[model samples]
Target: MSKPSRLWSIVDRRIHPPLLPLTTQDSQRLLDTIKNSFRAQLEKEHGLTDTIQATPSTTATNKVQSISNATTEPPRAFARPTDQHLHSILKNPLFSHQQQLKRQVVPASSVESDKMIFKQAVAKGLMNITRAHGFLLKVAGQKNTEPPVAKIENHGVGTLVLEWLRDSGQHRGLKWFSSSPEFGGLLIRFLLAEGHDELLLIWLDQLMTKEVSLGATGEWGITSMVFRELIKAKTLDPTLDDAYRTFLTGMNMLEGYSLSGKFFSTAWRELCWSTTVLAWKYPKVPAHLFEPFAASKLAKDPRDPRAHELPLAHLGLHHPEKPSVELALEWLRRHSFGYPAKMLLPAGSLEMARCLERLTSFGIDTAQHLLLSNQEEEAKGVMEYVKKITKILREKDHGLLPEAAP
Candidate 1:
């Protein structure tokens, strides 16, 4: 106890000091000392004798003000060239007055200006076409209304533009503009607004047949828009089946042209999904409508990885009501080791299971018909073919057979 008390007494005395309050005079003195020290430091560092400078005389101040005023004055505006200036520049001393007058009076050609104005007019007309179709109505917070057919007919803006292009021999411009999907789509809409279905089809045919290079691959050019619009029209009116069929025929016809055929094949592959959707909507449409596509060499070509997989798979899965699955089975039978058959048999196990079910049902139906006709041998073959396929598929995936088997 004595040793500990002695150590604590020494620590308290060394570490803790007595608190003391300062008077007003003491606080003022402390602040003056700090201010003097800071000012002295700043003056020493900046090489200044005094922290504040003396004010200038009234005359010096006035001189400075006048100098600032002179420097801050606004710049003068530019002036136009006078007739004298123009004459000095234009009247060469070597030429006579009559020759100079004749040269000045000769008119400048306005051809370039007219061409620029025509191009601007074409751009504006295209914009107006979109506006006529309610392109801007959404921007103005308004519901879209039908295109003003009466106004379009009265103005004849599109017609007049086309006529000018044709009459003025602007064939290149006309062809490029007509081939543009933007312009082509607007023109189609305009024609539809005017109830010119026959004209629309004719224009579409011309566009498809034109020699112009189809711009940029995968761009969904004029042909794609034609199919889109035709599909939309078919959806609204089922009787327009012939319209779609006619367009398909036209597209198929393009397969014969060398340059256009390449484009058509690409477009055909891309639009296979759309065709599947269309076929699904109208199952009554005959299977032959798509048979040409499914049976096309392009669909069966082994070189293209995307060739056989899409068209037949889409038909089998989506357009099952048609003879699409039959077409797929026939394709598989022919190309047993090809990519598509690989997809049907192994890679797409679940899909292959479904196809087998459909094949079995189809086989049963045929076998029943054969039995009714007293063709026992043919019926046995059909049944045996169905059994062989089922056995092969079951051996491929034993786990799926229990769930897939009826």
Candidate 2:
């Protein structure tokens, strides 16, 4: 028994000798003490259950601030934001990355040929340098719609000198000039065509730093081709650091939001299903990050899974178990220089033994597949990905083993 119970026993024996019985006053006092102890135990358990963990946006010690009025009148049953406040919450997170990230529909009636369009973009010095570096200063200087095209062709800049500089091993020129936003976009396209994500990250640091348009949404539009190049170079860790960077760029666009600035009515339930699938796919990747993203979108109204098919099945999956669309999203959130395949490791899962069992039959040509498909090896630091996790599993089992007699 517990100390309180033992103390109660001692007090009971002292106050009320079993056959002699207790005086009414002593009996009442003893009952009160025992009742108080039970109440204290109940309060202690409630406090333990109420302990909250810290999250990225919220600190643990933050006592929730209530904005209610100190009125004698009855308080409003619910709190609601003002209309303008709703707009910011509904649209502001994607305020910088909108239209540009979505592929614009090329108008059928537009007269410009594809060749002419590319050539004009090239001519305006748009392809040559960024609008920031005075490369487009002259084009931007003219108060005409056609000036950008003229600068490209008239400059006899058939080829940008930066390419030659890049090839010639002039490091300073490449860094200074390549960091230009206009050049960064072209270079990204060029790298995609050539299959070079790793090489592209050489310039990605600069690309990410370019002024994000405060214009209500932007896309981290670095295409798959460029991502492939990085996989070739072998750097993608699906760690928190990479995830933070992804958030800064327009890459991790929250897909559930709509243009009309409403959560798709069916979105909540579908996202929950998606999160559940991730959680169920244990011994693959943990549900730590995935869980919340899924949960946050799970319900504008919990009574529905509004969108049919979750609208993500069409996206590709890497491991047979992973939902491809979700992985693509997570990767955009900041794989950094890490590979895309890190999520495949056993240690990433909730269970270790399952990962080990599955690893036994892992494909040998996974890296080659990445090279072929333009993705890259798995999503983690390759060496430690396997070794460190194996050690963790080994230690777990060792701890569980029974000791022999000395």
Candidate 3:
């Protein structure tokens, strides 16, 4: 047996010559002739009349004539219903409301238009330099009354805002991007330039509470820098303790550097930099936490596990930590670096003198050989720097270390 032919075959058949044109009057006349013939047949077969009354004399001829004329006449173009009028008549307000409720939607074309406008605005602002920040803020749905930089209080919204700021701020200068306030100003301007503050803070909280793994992205370095900067500035906020704890927790998660680790490639230098900053700002942190990081970053062997490091000797001493053997040794090594040579007679030289006294009291012989060992040149200058510190210590007669409290 064969399958039956589909009705669509006939329904979709193409016309060769297409439709024949008909004049309005001719069409009206043809329609009237067909209608009258049908009516006459119905009247003869069923005895139906145009009028309901069966009077011998026709009393409603005018009404019958008017009905006949209406069916026979062609509709005038000016009087015909437009598509808009037909749509209005066909659509009901209640039905439209129900449709909207079923699926709240914006037309895709409009959404695409909006996204394009946003991109163009961002590009223009970035290129102009002067208007970049203002343009970005406006495009992010910020109102005129709202500040350019805002603390998004709502967690979800704030996270989104931070993400936007991060991506947009990356291409702009540090000053323009850092102009906004966040975390009550504990943010490192450099990290802010990196545009990961929200996620950084989230990781900070998660790591602090041990709720998360050290899942990568070199978060350790940023956390370290943030804490170091905060300590250096003496910006004591109540939440800082928890934040610092998180940084320690994140540091512990690293099982030593490896090629396969997540975010490992980008995180090493950052973490190294953090270590340098922390070593400089040692007194503000716990000895136990600082010791391991300080030791690892200062490794002497080229093949040592933590040998790859960046130089950061430019940061000068300010509000120096109370003198200790470890602190003094690291200080001397850092100060000896040619890029940041110790000043001959600066304000903090007195603090350096005190550190030297403490180093001697603790017994300089105990200081590790690798403490001063960098490249050969760096190693050679170590004793000279140490002697200078010792001389200052003797001349100042500051033989005691400050109390062991931060």
* Predicted structure with the largest lDDT when compared to the true one: 1
Which structure is stronger by TM-score: 1 or 2?
1
Candidate 1 residue-wise lDDT, 124-229, digit = tens = 4432334332332221223543321221221233343344444445533334443544444344444443466665566555656563455434434545456455
Model 3 off-target regions past 4 Å?
A: 1-198, 201-243, 256-283, 295-323, 326-406
Q: Give me candidate 3's TM-score against the actual structure.
A: 0.26
The residue-level lDDT of candidate 2 at 331 comes to 35
Question: What lDDT tens digits, residue by residue, belong to model 2 across residues 94-131?
Answer: 23233332333443532222323333343343433333
- Quote each prediction's TM-score: 0.35, 0.18, 0.26
Q: If ranked by lDDT, best first, what sequence of candidates would result?
A: 1, 3, 2
Best by TM-score: 1
Q: For residues 332-396, write the lDDT of model 3, one tens digit per residue.
A: 55544431222222334554553454334322322333343333454345555656556654443
lDDT value for candidate 1? 0.46
Higher-scoring candidate on TM-score, 2 or 3: 3
Comparison by lDDT, 2 against 3, better one: 3
Checking candidate 1 for backbone clashes, the offending pairs are none
Please state the error at residue 352 of candidate 1 in Å.
Answer: 24
